[model samples]
Target: MSGMEGPVLVVPGLNGSGPNHWQSWMEALIGARRVDQDDWTRPDIDLWSARVADAIVAQARPVWLVAHSFGCLASVVAVSRLADRIAGALLVAPASPDKFGITARIPDTPLPFPTVLAASRNDPWMKFMSAARWADRWGARLIDLGEAGHVNTESGHGAWPEGLELFRQLQASAPAMTGPLQD
Candidate 1:
């Protein structure tokens, strides 16, 4: 297996992932580090994006971002500005809210690099159909997981195998468009 090129950074939702959260499991699999933010608990999009960008630069070169909930939102917002810096992204359970001052900011466009959106059908944070629609808008491959509430530990989804399979799929489907000129 190829040694990891860049650290796979994991971004948690509003509350952040606890020990049992799926993102934590992902950290174990790929040596992922969280997107460090100044204020993690608050849903401040701009600050969150800035933190993501900074963390992306510091954590790994040619970074492959893996974000969940609010973290996913932060990544999406920053990726367009950091296009030249990223290889690919794996966004899961993005926190899109109409009242939290972020819903209007989400792009109706697809991200430049290879990307995927894994959403749950019964997530308290997002409706399945709405998440699928966002995926369609962003031109991301959508994996509709049935009844996986929020796809977090609260939903009884600690270390989800299916989600991990989806990550493997993303890694396999897309080639990293990074590194020095490898002739």
Candidate 2:
């Protein structure tokens, strides 16, 4: 849990994580790389999914996903495509695809890798029950973060160290993959 074997892919939500966002702090603290989306404000589900998949493909080593908001949805979509490359995932404050006026694209099947879905009780983007439903469907563990307001800087969490702790727990519990790292 203390040390992960591969690159930590930091995926942000709308407008991308600002310099002071927790995801950015994670990058600074653990040397994670951001999944670059072509357009941050206007999120296209397919495009975001593709970007996540591409990031995994580019990595020779195993990749651990640290995704927030809409990025969590994209990472979920990309998981099946990059299952072998993913070590585990931390999905924080997932923004329901339905909120964007699009029909849900979430898959019904359980994810290939172990995952944790962190939900905020008072997040405007999604209801806690909806997140719990998603966790059930994806077979992910749901962690309730009470009244955390989307777990963003606007919610008073510029550096969410607790999220890092959750990632560590996931890593510790996940089964080890057998293949050699790409480098």
Best by TM-score: 2
**What is residue 45's positional error in candidate 2, in angstroms?**
0.5
Look at candidate 2 and tell me the lDDT of residue 134: 89
Model 2 off-target regions past 4 Å? 1-3, 181-183
Q: What lDDT, from 0 to 1, does candidate 1 have? A: 0.77
User: By TM-score, how accurate is candidate 2?
Assistant: 0.93
Candidate 1: tens digits of C-alpha lDDT, residues 1-183: 331365677877787888898889888877877776766678788888888888766643677788888888888888767776776787888776564776788777988777889888878788888889889888899887777777788888788787777777777677655464221
Which one wins on lDDT? 2
Candidate 1 regions exceeding 4 Å error are 1-4, 178-183
What TM-score does each of the candidates earn? Answer: 0.89, 0.93
Q: Give candidate 2's whole-model lDDT.
A: 0.88
Error of 2 at 8 (Å): 0.7
Root-mean-square deviation of every model: 2.8, 2.1
lDDT of 2 by residue, 1-183 (tens): 333677889999999999989999988999999999989998988999999999988887778999999999888888876787888999999998798765457776788788999999999999999999989988899999999998998998798889889998898888775455553
